[model samples]
Target: MSQPPPAAHHAGHVAVIGRPNVGKSTLVNALVGANVSIVSNRPQTTRHRLLGIASVPGGQLVLVDTPGLHREGGRLASSALNRVLNRAARGALEGVDAAALVVEAGRWDEEDALAYDTLRASGLPVVLVVNQVDRVADKASLLPYLQRINEGREFAALHPVSALKRTGLDALVASLLAQLPEQPPLYGEDEITDRSQRFLAGELVREQLMRQLGAELPYATTVEIESFTEEPSPKAGVMYRIGAVIWVEREGQKAIVIGKGGTRLRDIGKRARERMEQLFDAKVFLQTWVRVREGWSDDESALRSLGYGDS
Candidate 1:
């Protein structure tokens, strides 16, 4: 008997949407099997629309990881920055075949509803992803929560998963792939993301900023890669020399990021360099400087200059 022919391949774009801090980036990173998107405990960690390609035996998923959908009226809100982030998230819905509406397991709120509404309005297949299931102490309680949220709502599929631990992802991936059109792969199997290495490098540095600075750091702070260059290395094969500027809205914020005697900045650079080296598979020499930008986050021109307006 002849062996059965290989399964037909499916490929298309799927937007990952959720409120801030709901593990959307983590889910994207897990699905892509790489750190294509940065993750932090802070809300709005992702400020851009990034494509993470996940290739499997029968299908390939082009995952559009987007900024968290959030309200912009809070005291901590940076109006321009928040608008940019929200726009990036909503804009990602355009030209997508499906959407993954991610929310923390056992909880759903107005922002979550907002994300679902946005996806529904696009007329795309919305797959409800209840992420972070590992944190749910009582697995039994999850059924009730899932049922409660599913009431009077429509979803192509629903999955309870833990993006951090990589559990329940196979089913989720299958559900998403099922919704995609049957076609050839959109990208090479080796390709993981559409973003360039330079952009990833800058994001890695910003990840350190959010992780290290926490609440003390201003919400308006952003990272700009002033310079990124590669050189041949005798032992490491390649080396990267990256200069990053940490843009802050106030001179006092600069002092805070710099810390006493520049130690804080040094630690941030050290950690960022380590991450870049790991991600790029090369040696990294990273230099970081904190500078005052005087409300750059709220300034459209400045935001555009700092690479904030892209979708």
Candidate 2:
């Protein structure tokens, strides 16, 4: 196939919007060919807006991955944190060329509708991304589900894909590129994300916390990088020395993260370091500690200080 001329290429920002835990970050990571955004099974695992840049054959996609949109009134929702997350997600929509409304292959709910409505109000071209089709035992049922979601809704394109498996992405990319305006690449092809390595380091530790602790983990718990230093290494090209502090609401939660005899914390640090080595492609020395923050998640000032502000 003949390559499109440089003047014919399309490049623009696209907001990835969805309800909590619908694999928005996973899709972005798959498209970017890197783990620029953190992923976990927990709802609202993504707390900030980050951009993943994917330079494909026909064009470049600057994907804005945002926190899942959820109602703030639930008992499980921290009013302040929920407000911050919702604001961050909504704020990410500004100046984007298009939006991708992600949803699980077989599921749709009020929150899904809310996300779609929010994007519709923005007046951007939306592409329905039916993600996680690999999880569906009955593939035939997906057609009806897709039709149901499409009812009374207008979308620039729709695709069923498995972000984890990286299937059905070529078509998705082509569809999204058709919606974008023809232009040059907005970023260097080598650039994968807008977030710095320091931010990603903290998120890697938090990903461990969410994956390991599961239901035992408190919503108030967050990872903060106290120190991030890079130094020369004899064997490796670069070495990163990182210090992470896990903040919890109370002493009990701190104990849960630290675990008995500090085994849990060690595992978290070890896994996080391995991931960092992979993502940064450099040796990493990571140290972690758990501390009680009383009520940081609820305090708007503290949340901003911890890097949870609207982005």
Give the alpha carbon lDDT tens digit for every residue of 1-311 in model 2.
99876557999999999999999999999999998998998998999899999999979999999999987687556578888899999998999999999999999999999999999999999999999999999989999999998999999999999999999999999999998999989999999998889999999999999999999988889999999999998999899999999999999999999999999999999999999999999999999999998878878999999999746
Which RMSD values do the candidates have, in order? 1.2, 2.0
Question: Backbone collision count in every prediction?
Answer: 0, 0
lDDT values for all models: 0.92, 0.93
Kindly list the per-residue Cα lDDT of model 1 for residues 183-269, writing each as its tens digit: 999999999999998899889989998999888878888999999999999999999999999898888999999999999999999
Model 2 ranges off by over 4 Å: 1-7
Best candidate, lDDT: 2
Q: Model 2 Cα displacement at 307 (Å)?
A: 0.7
